[model samples]
Target: MPPDPHADELRSPPEPFSSRRPTWDDVGRVADLLAAAERTRTGVVATRAEDVRVRWLMLDGLEDVVLVEEPGPEPVLVGVGEYSTELDLLDEATVVHVEGQVHPAATGRGIATHLLDLAETRARSAAAEEGAETAIVRTTVIDGDDRARAWFSTRGFVPVRHLLTMRLSLDEPPRPPTWPEGITTRRFRPGRDEVRAWTAHSAAFADVPTHFPLTLEEWVEDRILRDPAFDPSLTQLACDPDGEVVGLAFCRAGVEGAPEEGWVRDLGVVPAWRGRGLGMALLLDALGTFRTRGLTGAALDVDDVTIGPAVRLYERAGLRIVRRIDVVERLTSTG
Candidate 1:
């Protein structure tokens, strides 16, 4: 099988290494690798697939060694890559980001540690070119993936925020709320314009400390080009009398796994849109959609300390945290 079209195309001058871009042929094998390594503790199927695609970059470069299991009667897990990565500045600041995968079979080896170090050096160099002061590398470990989290902490990252995987059983009818006076909610049918909706989303979320301002092209690419990100019928939007998209709830499903589960990649009712019960209404609508699709449950991840008391709301709705994970940042040399 050929590599996936979405995999990065490597164009470096000839070197001793050989890299093969991961194709669709690699997806099933990669999926097996993830299961065997127990690398991912809990995640939406779509999100996991995205990670698989991102990791293909190291393979295409070939310079990064791959320890994949020999494809035969019984495949085994091996590690991938040793690529050094560095800074990619956003606007004027140097940024540190890492996207790589592990061979589930090779869990105890310090492969991830080595990759992170190489990437950190690249990040520092990238920051230097941009005249930025600091950079931070990031990764996630499932609550069950204790060893991985310890590995990250040993290298300097700390637990900053805890994310909870919450689920709402969709077997029953959702009791949606009635919006407050002058505020109304509706579904965002496919093919309609979402520019203003995006604008509202941007304005409402402008205060989030470290979010990137995505261009319209990027938004389109994210929601449209991404196959698993489709299914607009599952989206609900809240609007005011002036027709502003102040609140939004979007749900997507996993193709590789359970079809009976609808995952909420995001559900936010802008601050201005809050207090009117729009959040609950949007959530109810999403749950209804999931139920309509015959899904047994609806899932979403929320920050334990979000701007609003989201955890409380989920608890009230009969949803409980199924998994817990943390994201930490090492404050750069702040003067």
Candidate 2:
């Protein structure tokens, strides 16, 4: 049989390089490369060391699959890439999620192409080991990044979703918040509310695209119990008159690189509570909390505009789109 078309697209670009796996200690340097890449491409320093640490922990087969280019003493990390299948949140049974970044200055060196080749191969091997029958490969690029998008398109990846990163300046006072009748809000209850908060958030976003609800254990490990930045004070939740959790505006005090900004990581109102203005109230309340803490601004990512009236709610809250990211995927096998 001829070479697999899917595999053909992932062929590495002609380039000479060596690679190695990264350790937890490499988080700082990896973060530096990420910041450098983001600054060169978007004129902003967005990636943070903590984000890198969290992502590293989330990856499947970290040491086996992750690649660090030009590895050696005084080596420059021109590229980093990895594939993860453990968190396949899509409806599909098996998916190998590939993500990577190349130093902006190193773009033309075919580092990204080579990285994809490594990532896909490792991902396929991993899926087989896990007893998954076939798998899809998914990746994402900023919507404004034509070069990246074109490269992926030529490789047979098709755009499947769009996510927006929205921002709000705290320079102007946040509009005064109004709590809906029969509803009250409070900071997360550290010891007692971990499961409750997860349930509320997962239920609220259950129908949203790309939302794969995590098991309670996964939720605890990822955020609530162990994440260093788990500031109970900043993460807010809405409670019904009977004191049941009904909505949440989960906020992070700031990321490692940009500590002055606040992040509304997620804001959701459970289905039964939708259309009652709880989401808007929770959002404003979170902004108010961030403002009270003297944060410079706030940000969040919306999986898409049509997920609900979420876009409008965000707009009314003074958050504006700062970036658009596209999710692309290629079916590697159908069996």
User: TM-score for all predictions?
Assistant: 0.68, 0.77
lDDT values of the candidates?
0.61, 0.76
Please state every model's RMSD to the true fold in angstroms: 6.5, 6.0
> Model 1 reaches what TM-score against the true structure?
0.68
lDDT of 1 at 62: 33
Per-residue lDDT of model 2, residues 250-273, tens digit only:
788885446788988778888988
Q: Per-residue lDDT for 150 in model 2?
A: 90
For residues 1-118, could you state the per-residue lDDT of candidate 1 as single tens digits? 5544323313221232223434456656665666655535554333355455555543444333233343346544454433433443333445455544566544555555545554
Candidate 1: give the clashing pairs: 3-23, 4-23, 18-62, 19-62, 37-104, 86-122, 86-123, 87-123
Clashing pairs in 2: none
Error of 1 at 161 (Å): 4.3
